[model samples]
Each structure stands twice: as structure tokens, then as C-alpha cells.
Target: MRSAPRSMSEEVIPLVEESAVVGKREVVTGRVRVRTVTDTIEELAQADVQHETVEVTRVPVGRVVETAPEIRTEGDVTIVPVLEEVLVVEKRLVLKQELHIRRRVEQEAVEVPITLRKQRAIVERTDPEDPAPEGPPT
Candidate 1:
């Protein structure tokens, strides 16, 4: 029997395939951590504080005056006169009483306990690759 020749369109062709590979990995670059710490320190501070107190005393006074006396101060003692008008058929003025205002200043050495605070930064570095620790992160 005679064999027939194949047509151009019927001819078979072999082909090779090429492809790209995709992948992912995890890398430990570094780490950062924050922490808070507290510390105490001693310091000295000076300030002026005022304290007020009152003292009273009485004495006998038997006198009569025409007009009110003027306010005066001697040393740290202040003298103030209280007056009233003695009324008769005619209008009149008379010294009634006196009031004294006194002021005293005293200072005592005192030791005060106070609390102070301060902030400081401390950093440490570590690497998985290195067996020893690095001194600081920076």
C-alpha cells in the first residue's frame, strides 16, 4: 500500500515550558523596648514663711482729753487712741480709751525634708547572632 504525506497544518511540534519561583522568609533585624524607672535625690530649698500671733494686756488709765490723739508707733509697737464725744447740753469731745497694735519678728532654724525627682535614660542592645551583649543600643 502507498503512504500519504501529512499536511503542514497537521504536523506536530514539541514545546518546553519556563516558570518563575516565588518565596518569602522571616529576618530578625533588631528590637526596641521601653521602660520606666524611679530614683530619689536630696536637695536644699529656702523660702520665707510668716506667722502671726496676737497678745493683749490691760492697764489703768484715768485721764480726760479734748481731742482724739494721733496714731503713733514706737519700735514695733503701734499706739492707737479710741475716743468718744462726751455729750452735755453743749457738744464736746473727750478721749475714751487707747488700743495698742504690736508686731514682733522672730526666726528659728528649721530643717525641712523634701522629695525631688529626676529622669534618666538607659539603653541596652542584644543580637541573636552575637553571643555577648552590646553595651548600648546607640
Candidate 2:
């Protein structure tokens, strides 16, 4: 029974741990107010519109055509061919006057009267010691 062997700063023992450092700050929790309202409406609209009119007629063809007569569309009637170069017994290509064009389309029924405008947004929630609300939050 003999015990004696312990020396290196007495077998070292020195320790301590305890820490707390937490920080954050920003607080102003309540302020929002907005307002805008406008509305107007009146409407009456209808449409069916088409108009085209052209009528020209002059027909007198004294007959004699060997060449130069090509402008024809017959149904809506459009025939334009008028040419005359005649010296009797040598040069003849005469069929003077023919210009008949007719086109007519008319349909009319129209009425229009319109005025419209609309806008709406209104929200209110204010409390930051309540004394800052009179005008300017939109």
C-alpha cells in the first residue's frame, strides 16, 4: 500500500463554457390606406354599312373591227372598247364608243353612342398611434 505519482500541473483540469448574445430590431406594425373610385357607363352600338355606286353608259358601235377589242366582263356589265382608225379602203379598225360600267351596292343601318370608364380600389387599416390620416395614401 503505497501511492505517489501525479505531477504535470496536477493532471490538468481547467474548463468553462456559457454564452448568450442575440440581437435584432425593427418595429412599426400598422399603416395602410388607399382609395380610388370612378365609374361611368352608357352604350348603344349597331353596325351594317356598305355603299358603292357607279353607272356610266355610252354605246354606239358602228361596226368594223379586225383587231383591238378586248375588255369584256358581262354579268356585272363592264365593256370598255373604243377605237377608230379609218381611211376607208385601206386602213380600217372602227368600232367607236362603248363604255358601260355598272356597279351598285347599298346597305345602311348604323347607330353609335358610347361612354365607359371604371376604376375601384379602397382599403384601410391604420394604427400607429392614429393621427396621420387626412390626405395622401393612394
Candidate 3:
């Protein structure tokens, strides 16, 4: 015959949504409050980088080489076009351009609700409230 002491009041819920980049993310953490964000956006940029030049040629081939230079006299003919005279090289490239004008400042972080009014004294209830744990969620 004991049933009269049920009065609990605690309500605090604020959870924002919308967060992209699923599989991988380097870094992301946000909370902001700057007078509800006014209006100011300025950005200046310039980029034109170009430098590339190339011209290369090389050929060398002559094997089964048996030489006896006396104008090849007696036995063994003469057909010399050994092939070795083709070379041209030129390559130059440079790139360095930097321009800047960036002024951006934004800040906001405000989430406050802390109430631990008091209720923590049940050293051991001997485990008997588990209709699939109908507990801990207020």
C-alpha cells in the first residue's frame, strides 16, 4: 500500500539538423551568433598562370657491327647509313602569381540550459526494472 509521490518536470530540447559530407570530412564544428548575421560580403581575385614549352628528338641505332675500315676490301660489302643524327632539345616553363584581398569575420556559439536540480540517491535497487530497460531518458 505505497503509491503517492510522482511529480517530475524537465523539458529542454534543441537539436539542429542539416550536415553534409558523408563519407569523409577533414573538419567541421559550428555554433554562431553575430547579431543574426547582417549583410557584408567582399571578395577580389585574379589568376592567369601559363608557361610550357617542349621540343625533343633523339635517335640512335646500329648493331651487328663488324668493322675493318680499309674501305672494306675483299669480302663483305659496304652499306653505311648506320643512322645516328637527330637531336633537338628545348624546354622552359615558369609560373608564379599571387593576388589577395580577403576580409571575412563570422562568429556564433550560444547554447545554454543546465539544470541538475537534484535527485541521486539509490545506492542499489537490486536490478528489477527491465521490461527492456524502461529507464534513463528525461
lDDT of 2: 0.87
Give the C-alpha miss distance for residue 39 in model 2, angstroms.
1.9
Per-model tally of clashing residue pairs: 0, 0, 3
Decreasing lDDT order of the candidates: 2, 1, 3
- Give me the displacement of residue 132 in model 3, in angstroms: 37
Residue lDDT tens for model 1, 40-133: 8887666666677655444334356766679887777777777666668977666656666676666655557787987667655556565544
TM-score, each model?
0.53, 0.38, 0.15
User: Model 2 over residues 1-138: C-alpha lDDT tens digits?
Assistant: 897886656566778978899998987788878788888889877899999999989999889889988999899999999898989679989899899998999999999998888999888888977777777765
Each model's lDDT comes to 0.65, 0.87, 0.35
- The digit string of per-residue lDDT tens for model 3 on 36-110 reads 223334433334444443322232333322332232222222322322232326322211211122233444444
Candidate 2 regions exceeding 4 Å error are 1-16, 21-28, 31-38, 41-51, 70-79, 82-97, 102-111, 127-138
Instruction: For model 3, name the residue pairs that clash.
Output: 31-108, 32-108, 33-108
Kindly give the stretch of ten consecutive residues in candidate 1 with the minimal lDDT sum. Answer: 54-63
